[model samples]
Target: MIAHGSLILVLLFTSPLMEAFSQPTKVVTLVMFKWEIKEEARLLERRMLYLHETLDVR
Candidate 1:
């Protein structure tokens, strides 16, 4: 019973530390994802403008 109680206490303490360590990674991934989305959008816009310019020239 004592060992079981200590194990529970250990888990309770470690879970928050684990969450703290993991939280920044989640934020970093979200930032990276947003940046990638913005880059893709800019590329698509550039491609569309290029297509329009070529069509206008021809």
Candidate 2:
């Protein structure tokens, strides 16, 4: 019973540290997603410009 209680205490103390470690992973994922979106937007813009130029030439 005592061991179980101690284990619970350990978990309680460590949970916040675990959460803190995970927070940065979430931020990194968000930043990476944002960059991916920006890159995709740039690619789309380039494609649109190419299409516009092709249409104008025709």
Candidate 3:
């Protein structure tokens, strides 16, 4: 019975630590995704500008 109680306590303590460790990975992934989106937008804007210049030249 004592071992079981201690095991439960250990699990409770570690669960929060595990969640804390996982949070940073999630944050990094979200940050990376945002950066990718921003880069894509920049590329699209550049392409549009190039197209506009070509049309203007013609």
Candidate 4:
């Protein structure tokens, strides 16, 4: 009974170590893309021009 209990304790402690060694390493990559805001700026300028034209067209 003592041997059986010792074996069980040994197996339980070793299982987690075996699992860590058996798994492959994982690589994680974070990618970010920067987009130019020129188009948005042009759109805002056009809106401002339209507002100016409406106010000045009278």
Candidate 5:
């Protein structure tokens, strides 16, 4: 009975730590996704500027 109680206690303590560790990985992924979106927007802006400059040359 004592061992069962200790096991439950260990599980309760570890669950939050497990959740904390998992949360950062999701946050990192979201940050990386946002960075990628920003990079894509920058690339599109540059392309539009380049197109306008070329059109003006003609």
Candidate 6:
């Protein structure tokens, strides 16, 4: 429980900095960007559940 609590606290403290760094770049278009994804290897999902318009089209 303490580990989770401390993780939450750390996330809360650095959220703004993380958000600034989390902005999406190299947007996917035509479904081909999966080839050049830079962040991670999984379909690329946002964990915050925010309604962000990526403006990407396939």
Question: Backbone collision count in every prediction?
Answer: 0, 0, 0, 0, 0, 0
Among these predictions, the greatest TM-score belongs to 3
Candidate 3 local accuracy as lDDT?
Answer: 0.96
lDDT of 5 by residue, 13-57 (tens): 999999999999999999999999999999999999999998985
RMSD of 1: 3.2
Query: Global lDDT of each model?
Result: 0.96, 0.95, 0.96, 0.69, 0.95, 0.58
Residue pairs of candidate 3 with colliding backbone atoms? none
Q: Is candidate 1 or candidate 2 better by lDDT?
A: 1
Error of 1 at 26 (Å): 0.9
Q: What are the per-residue Cα lDDT tens digits for candidate 6 across 13-36?
A: 799767766654323352456655
lDDT of 2 by residue, 1-58 (tens): 5698899999998999899999999999999999999999999999999999889963
Give the per-residue lDDT digits (tens) of candidate 3, residues 1-58.
5698899999999999999999999999999999999999999999999999889863
Where in model 4 is the C-alpha error above 4 Å?
A: 1-36
Q: What 10-residue stretch in candidate 3 is worst by lDDT?
A: 49-58
Badly placed stretches (over 4 Å) of model 5 are 1-7
Residue 56 local lDDT, model 4: 91
- TM per candidate comes to 0.68, 0.68, 0.75, 0.35, 0.73, 0.25
Lowest summed-lDDT stretch of 10 residues in model 1? 49-58
